[model samples]
Target: MTIRTTHVGSLPRTQDVVDFIFARERGEAYDPDAFDAAMTGATAETVRRQVEAGIDIVSDGETSKISYATYVKDRYTGFAGDSPRNSPADLKMFPSFLERLKNDGGTPTYARPMCVGEVRSKGQGELEKDIANLKAGMEAQGVERGFMNAASPGVISLFLQNDFYPNREAYLAALADAMRDEYRTIVAAGLELQLDCPDLALSRHMLFTDLSDEEFVKVAGMHIEALNHALEGIDPARVRVHICWGNYEGPHVCDIDMDKVFSTLMGAHCRYVLFETSNPRHAHEWTVFRDRKAEIPDDKVLVPGVVDTTTNFVEHPELVAERIARFAGIVGAERVVAGSDCGFGTFAGFGAVDPEIAYAKLGALAEGARIASGRV
Candidate 1:
């Protein structure tokens, strides 16, 4: 198998595309045909840029969706836009969590309904639409290797406040079963599928903040079980799973130790594990893998983030190369791929780094990978 370097999640969005989509959605005067043309053009450009920069695997830039998690509310049944609210205080990344608490008895207010839906099985029509778009984009760009990100069943349950489900277990299981169809569809399309699962760790801090550490682990274990259930029968080689603390700039106090989650994460039937390791907050922790490298089975690949996503400073190519070399040293170079800490654009309305700078960072990442590979 060819080992390559890439990003864990999103790239920055073009300003014109972002403004155009929001304005049209909000009923401002914007032409639909023009919007489509611009979006397609921008997406193609983004992919071409990444490829030119030397990324082995490419993505559609996720420009079509606002936030990775909330975007699904519209397509899945049982969700309606709720009030816009601040992220939870216990969530660990949002600095305004406490300030939002000062009002309404310390509960963060939401503008949307906090995802009031239950996921249902994906129909063939929806699957075809998603795959066709991806395939069309890939064909247009002449790129053969690409992956599409989908929300894991656990993440869906956590983000979408499913008040309708009798209990959390049932809600999560339903989501897992519902999303299985989507998973199968991606596999059937003969393209790589990436399960975007930041909630794996973020949930412990945000949703279960009141629970004891032990209690949080139990609940998190259940979420992992549900995720595994959803991944059933999918070819491990074709799938990759990504996990991270919430992708924002803040104190990551709730960051769960990778050791605690490693066993459960490795249980998922994915060949590649895309994880955060380059951010200043977590860079030192890469040593944890050095100690635990033996536990990683031979069948799996590790894509550690070599580029920090929260900052604008382009990582020095030598530094990026060094990070990649470190991981390759621990887990043979053939089994290591370089990646970014997290998505550049986790949410639609919020971005900590400039878009142009984000692209430059990715370019640096690809260059760094080349340097590392040459050294190996």
Candidate 2:
């Protein structure tokens, strides 16, 4: 495997690109072809810059999708005619949920429906197109071993309300089956699949807010079971699972502790674990790994977040290098890959950091990885 670092998903969006997409959607007279051409050009340039800056695995910067979860929702069926309505809760991670509710106050409630559809039947063509475009871009830049991010079944179930399913378990299973198609598509395309599973932790807030800590763990286990079933039969080596405490700058007062979720996360069928560890709130918890290293298998890789996404200030190269060195010291250098605390743009229309700063942070990440690799 190549020794390098990269983002989990979503780079900050340029103002021009954001304005273009939103304007075009609102009946503004923007040239559709020109907008697409500009997006493609921008994405290609972004990938090339990451590669030139010393990152080994480059994404198309998730330029096409708004947020990892909502982007996939648009292509799938079973969503209610209404869009997601934000609920008032300080426990949620993304700020857009609240912003949406504030702006469109009284929108209908949304839920995920029980999909009776065939697995991998729908979205096959779209998946193929995305992979083909990514492959072409990678080949042009001599970058190999590209990967793409997909929303986990658990996340889909969490975001989309389950109004149509007979019950919650049935609903989750159906979603798992539906998402299995996407997992297979990425694997068949020979691209590494990074399952963005923020819901693994976020669910604690939404589902079991009143439950005891132990009770929440019990509830979360069911979600892990559904995710494992969805991921069943997939080769673990090519699969990576990402989990976080909601990707937003908020008072994570009710966020579940990693100790409560580590066992469930270990049960996931992925060879690599991409986790948030760069932000101030969670960075100190790296000691959790040092204390519980025994729980992690040696064969599995750890991609810890070395860059904090909530801030615009680019991390010092030496600071980035130290974060990587800490993880490498604990779990062999070869098994450690640097990553961001979370996607710079977890939501489509919201971001705290500027796009230029986001790329600069990635540049610093790549530089730091080089420094750490040399030391190791």
Candidate 3:
């Protein structure tokens, strides 16, 4: 069987698109028409490049988005004001690293929109535009299979603090209800829907660090419940859930262990599970399948990441093939889809990886998938 390959979501945005997004974010005057044109060109170009690199499933590269989850602040209503500095618990452990980063040109503080009122769909036009661009890009590249990534309710709540909601459950439910439009739109347009639920893993430290391990799982489980509610009518086969322990070049000592949340992740309603496996901190976790092989349902597809996104070092095709082969050996080849540990350009211009190197890695990933298909 052919081993399908895909990435977590965001790809490197063209310099033009990058500049436009940054300019707008900085409140600088930029031509809206030019930005729109650049987004269209970048989407088409990224899609074509993915096909050229031998990727089976492509994305719009998220060229129009500023960041993965924070972009929702622009599309939805009720997200007003900002909350406290909710820093990641892992980062707090490395005070020296934080100082070094601060000394070396600080990171951009992306908007953290709080839930000040009721959530509603004000960004449907933007989403429709994204859909149009994806369809156009697919036609231009002559590639049919594609997917669009949307933020999960849990993630939105994690990034965008909620001072308005009475409690966590109420906030998450509202976010799920608001994001349903985007999810349904992508699937209805005949593309797979990739729900980015970093909260399931990352939040264990980032936002829910105060809770015990068991308590955090229960909290994360609620997020999955809200996600299922959002995905009520969509076919699970057409949906993929991507969970990560925060996508960054951090110590990651605080990341929730994969086994700790394995059951919670599988409990997600999506049929396809996309997770990180290439990062050094979590690379060995792929063996979990061998240990808990029986728990994986027959209908589920394991899309383990074979490419690392947090570094510039390009991985060899053989290494990627070996990674995929390992998973295939435990499960079956037909049930695996090669993926990236996380997004290459998760937050628009804030990618840790170099843009050109990111594409090279994709090429390596595709080539690696081809190699594994033969061996598996």
Candidate 4:
């Protein structure tokens, strides 16, 4: 098959779903049954839109999630409602931006869930609902393959501060143990499982700015171990891993180079690696694959973001095709898949790109893949 087109999970939610989420976040009483119905409808609609845009592998738009990583708090036990608030070092460096966010009421103020007790999966029912919703959407659309995004143990640690654990290591181990059940369920449902693991690369600037390269790599290695452990008994072929240097537009000079951790990424047991490559910050880094193709396993596929998610600009189809062709030249067409740099709506109510433009970009991505396929 030629290079296929997909995107990082998450698409903009309709106004109704957004309101329901905000109501819950504000501690206002809301109807659980109503929320579930709304979520199911939204998931189905999102999937239909993805197929309409010609995406090969679609997701439920993570419509049921508040945020990609922190949504785990609701599905698992041991997390307290009162999560600590912290800012990325990059954001902290520019306090004016924070002030602007506050002024615009865009500075999300949800409590960060803390590890207040030992972690355990609430039940399979929570994830099963998602699986069922996604399956229903795929059935409705008559699509073949789809994926679901789950927060990695490491990303959970990065987003939700650990207060109860004796140390970070202890906290991460508990998270991995608890999240394994969810990981297994998705794959068992005959869907690809995409583990969102920004902690490996994004946390260096966002949360671990205080650590040195050696110390950060040590921590990152542990993070990968926890993910691998959760992925045990699951075929690597059925799983794909995504890494990014945080999804926001910021001065990413502090971000760690992919070279520093490429080996660690290649070490993941998963057979596919999806990463940010279209944005200006990491665009040039795609050459790393050409320079160091030896680091990538032959069995794995490389899904590079040829469409930028941070900006509103709808990349020209030719530009998108050009980007895909670059990677195809390096990794071979069969081993390449076109994707977005990061999620368009990384958070429920926090999308920077316009919803209409997001779909337009996806159209461009599909067109680009078609153009690249011809060339390859």
lDDT of each candidate versus the true structure: 0.75, 0.74, 0.88, 0.88
TM-score rank, highest first?
Answer: 3, 4, 1, 2
Deviating ranges (above 4 Å) for candidate 2:
1-3, 15-39, 83-121
After superposing candidate 4 on the true structure, give the runs of residues whose Cα lies further than 4 Å from its correct spot: none
lDDT of 1 by residue, 161-273 (tens): 66677888988888888778877887888888899887678777767678876777677788878988988888889999998877765667667787777777777788999
* CA shift of 29, model 1, Å: 8.0
Q: What TM-score does model 1 achieve against the real structure?
A: 0.88
Rank the models by lDDT, top first.
3, 4, 1, 2
Give the C-alpha lDDT of model 1.
Answer: 0.75
Winner on TM-score (2 vs 4): 4
Error of 1 at 372 (Å): 0.9
Q: Is candidate 1 or candidate 3 better by TM-score?
A: 3
**Taking the tens digit of each residue's C-alpha lDDT, what string does model 4 give over 134-213?**
99999999999999999999999988888888998888888888988898899989999999999999888777778998
Residue lDDT tens for model 3, 141-220: 78879999899998888888888879999998898889988999899999999999999998888777889999999998
Q: Evaluate residue 103 in candidate 1 and report its C-alpha lDDT on the 0 to 100 scale.
A: 51
Clashing pairs in 3: none
**Steric overlap count per candidate:** 13, 3, 0, 1
Q: What number of backbone clashes does candidate 3 have, counting pairs of residues 3 or more apart or in separate chains?
A: 0
Cα lDDT tens digits, model 2, 211-285, are 787887776688778888988899999888888887765666677888778888888888889888887678887
What are the models' TM-scores? 0.88, 0.87, 0.97, 0.97
